[model samples]
Target: MKEKRYIMMVGAVDDQLSQVRASLTETMNQKNVITQWILSRDGIDAIGKVDNQKFDAMIIDAEAPRVLNADFLNGIGRHRNTNDCNIFVMSTQDQEQLHPNLQKYAFLQKPLQTEILLQGLSEALSQNLKPSMVEKFSVDVRVINALIKATMMVCQNYGLDQVDMEKPTPKLLELPWQGQSGAYLDIRSQVFSGGLILSFEKNVFLKIVSEMLGEPFTEIKPEISDAIGEISNIILGNAKSEFTSYGVEMTLPKILSLGQTIDQPAGSVSMLITFGTPMGKFFLEIIAHPRK
Candidate 1:
């Protein structure tokens, strides 16, 4: 059941809340949500609002006074409807300053873009969301998480400067991407079949490949496509043993050109796994069918 979401914005500092409002309003209509906003000039005031009412989501700015402590977080979530209430922490500082527990929640770079803000919100929503997906996908959440672990492993091997990922989200509509250069590998086992796709924006791809291959690439070249395939191979290869335990195996990667659309097989579900890097964001899409 889709319910009204009370979203509290703390330390807005300016007219930014309007930007968030506009963005959420645009997307909320598609998801059938009614978002109510609450404002606080500081964390102390925000604490009052949080304690008195139930909030599904709370966005806190780094500049919010007296909010960096664990006590604030400990207080804010108890009154939330779900134990997994969406909490976004925004900071201008490059290094993290929030409590260790708070660090796991969404952390946004300040001077934030409303578009990226919406993306962070969507990603956090996807993480905390749990309804009908397990039954519909017929796959355990552990399998999905293991895929994330495998992807992170590959990302680390490639020597990505920063490797932070949004938790996986299930996609119900057409998969939209800003960049078209990507690759996919077919995965199969006694219980699972489908494919895994690694995709990135053009600049992100160029930067990652350049760093991986020790060359400077300003634009797309045929070699870059091959590099994508090779990188994807390493990823699944690393996961092979782990997936073998789950009875999952993968085929060699197939490259996707600009604007190419992957054909989702019949009776399959796809999970969009987004990873944040110093360069930009890339995704690992698992389109899998868990057979009976």
Candidate 2:
């Protein structure tokens, strides 16, 4: 028998719903997943109808002021049909304050990137068929930027001197050890183990250390390596709170390592962000996978 298709609807304002519908339609076409969709202005009415119908997934555009309210989200969470269906929220506002009861739902941000949204949808839909331990998710650009900024602030607080800070560019480099290196952070979640691996150039590492230690250029040391690992741990801590609010659990502490090269795993996505500081050029490579 052919696989059962899914349904995705927009429960938000007219303009916001229109945008989501267009983006979702294009994404579904590419995946070739048959899906039914609709836009509903009233949350109560929408949930009432959805409760009686069947769908594989639902995309809720929380950007709409009327529908973004707590009561509305709560209503959707209470719906019976929603239990087995994948729920995705699209919003421009900070999702940290979303109703606690709605925390388990997935979310996408406004001005959505096609690839990112598609990847999120694919992962959510494939969740059931795949082994629970094999399921995974990625960090949104907004969250990633927040984590990077927090790391920089932590470095400053520790008296590290700042260097050249510039936007990250997407490019591949031939590393002496790892061969071709892609310019992006590939984040993932592991069922058994949880931690993050950050990849960056030696120069970037030196600059970050100098700023954090409030010292001038010097040779890398065990102390500096320890400090870098602690810094990564802090970033992960801050990022985890945001993830937890969305019903994603993260383990305590982050591990850091310094090496000439890193090996990229198969079936992973990459996000590239560049930073230029007065101290020097630094690139942050985030490779997150299951600990086990």
Candidate 3:
């Protein structure tokens, strides 16, 4: 069920990204993943694409429309950070030419070898570790990273400056969560299918919604009741780019009103992740019904 992934190539030669695409296509089938390739004319065009769309990953040429600089590379890296998209740089020059400020990406030498490129891509995923407990708990780290990054970005974008993630705990369908209002998106893919919920306390939810809508609210008004659902949609949408590798699909999120509660989602497995917010804490619960 893997979805086609989009890749952006900045300042690349015509054949550069295509060959990488071919190599990826050949290798991914063995792993049940598929990717779609997009070539950027140069740095300028690449910037536009990078800003407007969600690319699973990016490859940049040292030429960078001739050559790259610290400022430009850092700029792109900052933008890509929200979604944790990997960046690979292609260069025929010395490593010194790369920006020291940018360390989160991979540097590939020219005379590109498909094996090296693939290896770099693989290692990039492993480069950063997830929250210690979640890392050890989840069987798949990629999905965990994708979802966590999306959660942090969404909250931060909504004005939560320092969101802290907590370890995931096993969830029981029969148990209730501690949040006042919440929403969850039901996800389905080759690996698992279940509801992914983000629950928040009454104050945190209201404050977040207030920041979101530029209005203050002490209760869930008709105008603000859908805020949780919208937040859930954004989280899944951002993660969907990475989920493409899993061929994942999701349904519109359902809201958990302040008074309403559920024991668990319709899946057999559930893992709960917590994020600390200014007003209080919000929870991210991943409930999965693993498919054989």
Candidate 4:
């Protein structure tokens, strides 16, 4: 199944974003893929959203607030959450006004042209459609990007610094019933159905629950478990909206107790993505099966 594409407009005029949205809607639907667009007036929030959610294309304005510095523009290129983003800068002024860090990227002259915007988006979406091999699952890069973005965003939101993403590894064996705590959210579509799991080591889980509640205690209280579940919910919840736009619906997240494991369906490919944070290291896994 063709995954949906999401487009974001940062610091763009309302009319410009609207026109781009219309163009993307028409083009993507004709390809039998759902498309959605989101707009942000502030560049910082826009960056955060882009970091937390995967977008096939991002149209950013040169004059957007809080984006005047070269360092900030550079950060966008370096951030793992956005490094894969197909960025297109939009400017009302001439090229001289663009930050030095943004000079290498493609640009869109404002007042935006529908044809140009559609063309750029079409190209960006095409780039994302190329399939990648991750063990047995022919996973889409957008799926991996979305999961990574959500993990990084949660770490940032919790004041965790220097978050690191480890390389994803394929899981061919059954998940062990080790003493681990986690949460899972099940997602379903006519084309695919599976679940996303966020599991943590004992110490890491405690730290996350403690910091989230702004207290310093270490025990898996019922509330602590609930807190962990909420964190998983937030991560999946953020991704859920993105998937929904693409025609997939996700159900309420469920918590897993110590030593519990969710089994993947037959023929599904499972992969683990580990994240290192100030608190500790945890992993998020996607075990999915494609429905022909």
Top lDDT prediction, candidate number: 4
Question: What is the lDDT for 289 in model 4?
Answer: 75
Local distance difference test scores for all models: 0.65, 0.50, 0.64, 0.66
1 versus 2: better TM-score goes to: 2
- Give the clashing residue pairs of candidate 1, or none: none
For residues 1-292, write the lDDT of model 1, one tens digit per residue.
5546677788854666577677776565555555677888776788777666777777888778777656566766655543567777777763246566556555565566454466545444333334432123333232344566567667665657578876557775265543557887777754356777888877777876887888899988875777888777666676565566667766778887666666775677777768888877888776766444
Tens digits of per-residue lDDT, candidate 2, 146-229, equal: 456565665456444563334333333223222111122234333211223343355555655676567865565655655555
Q: List, residue by residue over 215-250, the lDDT tens digit for candidate 3.
A: 778997787788888888778888786788767778
| TM-score of every candidate relative to the true structure | 0.53, 0.59, 0.51, 0.51
Task: Supply the TM-score for candidate 2.
Answer: 0.59
Can you tell me which runs of candidate 4 are displaced by over 4 Å?
1-138, 177-179, 189-191
**Lowest-sum lDDT 10-residue window in model 2:** 176-185
**lDDT, residue 81, model 2:** 65
Residue-level lDDT tens digits of model 4 in 139-158: 33344445666777776676
Worst 10 residues of 1 by lDDT: 133-142
**Candidate 2: C-alpha lDDT:** 0.50
Residue 59, candidate 2: alpha-carbon lDDT: 70
Candidates 1 and 2 compared: the better one by lDDT is 1
